[model samples]
Target: MSHAPVLLAEAMTALALQPGALYVDATFGGGGYSRAMLAAGARVLAFDRDPDAIARGAVLSAEFPDRFQLIESRFSEMDRFVNEPLTGAVFDLGVSSFQFDEGARGFSFQADADLDMRMEKSGPSAAEAVNKLSEAALADLIWGYGEDDASRRIARVLVQERAHHAITRTGQLAELVERAVGGRKGARTHPATKTFQALRMLVNDELGELARGLSAAERALSPEGRLVVVSFHSLEDRLVKNFITERADARGRGSRYAPDLPPERAPSFRLEHKRATAPSDQETAGNPRARSASLRWAVRTDAPAWGELEAPALAPKAEAEWKKLI
Candidate 1:
């Protein structure tokens, strides 16, 4: 089943579509945005790392063969795939409903399935991280990535429990976390939410991919072309916000060190609006997931693209601790 695109109206309006121009749908989850782009008479290049999404996207490519192409790859690789200047690029980031709903994929705490969270279905699974990794490393990851304050306690419990049996299933892992933090009574959210989120982020290396995708978008967009991104979490939102602010340094706003910021390079983009855009109340009523989603967009400038981007490290201390397991 296909999932409805979040912030649909905001994304489409921000794109300001132009017929016969090239456009990129960077996430291509359910092909909702790609279908809309083709409907607006634009040629679309869609990317999805998930093989299942690419299979689903095949129908759209066939429907508009001349105007659509679907690449079974990550958005970070867009530059390697497409060299053409684009009229617009749209990124719908984070876990897709298709992945979340499929119990076999095991992304949700509510589901009883194998503890697997690989978006591409290849590489180290969450089971490995949970069953392996030091308690300190696990805790650091939870705190840094998931923003869970009780990460140390949760990690300590996971290590103690897994000594008897391998934490191979989502339900097993969830129960361990719940017992550690007290059962979910009068709790605003599930105790395992943060743990699951941290594991997912680490498994996917999502933050690194986001940084690369933003750089690729900056390189590929044409002058006056728009770049629209919709992110579901605060961490994702902060990255997008920083990317735009750094690239669209219109009027001397650089970073926290703006006043002491080094001499400027040629700004490659301009923000259409500074504030983060949110889904309409009506959209949120029908889709609660849209409640936390935030959209940020900018237009490409005539200036040349920046060289390479130096992405932030995912906590050196955590990485050091995790390296012992892998």
Candidate 2:
């Protein structure tokens, strides 16, 4: 199936694309954003951590050799490759349609596969996390990353099940979570959805990547350059919201969580839209996945870049344990 870029029109409008201007598609999942940017006559440099995404982009790169390039790396490292200040950059965050639909990739419970959720197909995988991490760490991961209230119960089940045999498959883990959660009757989504999401995010260091990528975008964009992001869940949306609001604040009072820090920095961005833009009902009807997506954007200012964003370490225990395994 062809991958549909969520909020395509909204994101394109946010970019305000200008012909010949260099723009970065920081998450070139299906090259949808890159293709659109190129169509608008922009010079596009796209980045993707997943090797599959890079392989899929070869045709687009070949078609526009002079105008388009696809880099197989994380968006957080974009600053290293982007020599010139950018005209615009867009991030379609979270799992791409291609990743979710391709059952063999192990991104979804729709089809059974290995418990591997590595975006770059490297480092430790979800299976290692499921079978090796302690019960307390698993609970922390699910509660912190997944935000599921039944995280402790789910974690206990994982520990118990894995003792008999390793949780090495997507189907196995999903079933375990479903049983742990008691099926959560009337739930629109699957019982294991959040569990799967948490594991995938951990395996990819997703929130950490986003925090770094936003900072990279801030450093790389020219004055008035657009930085657009589409995030799928509360955690991502909250981080994006805070990043923009904090930078756009003229007071520069630092974060409320860190009140002791000096408020000496100037505003680095202009937040034109205070609220995030969501897909229209019409769009959601066609693509159910668009239901949770939220789009937020900001225009870069002339002020000096701010300090590097620290990825929120929500579950220290889980993270510490997972680090040992990797």
For each candidate in the order shown, give its overall lDDT on alpha carbons. 0.87, 0.93
Which TM-score value belongs to model 1?
Answer: 0.94
Q: What's the lDDT for residue 79 in model 1?
A: 81
| All-Cα superposition RMSD per candidate | 2.4, 2.9
Off by over 4 Å in 1: 250-263, 321-326
Return the top candidate by TM-score.
2
lDDT of the structure predicted as candidate 1 = 0.87
Instruction: Check candidate 2 and list the clashing pairs.
Output: none
Clashes of each: 0, 0
TM-score of each: 0.94, 0.95
lDDT of 2 by residue, 1-326 (tens): 77888999999999999999999999999999999999999999999999999999999988999999999999999999999869999999999988898888898989999988889999988999998999999999999999999999999999999889999999988899999999859998999999999999999999999999999999999999999999999999999999999898834444777656555578899988888999999999999889999999999999999969998898899999988887
Model 2 error, position 292 (Å):
0.4
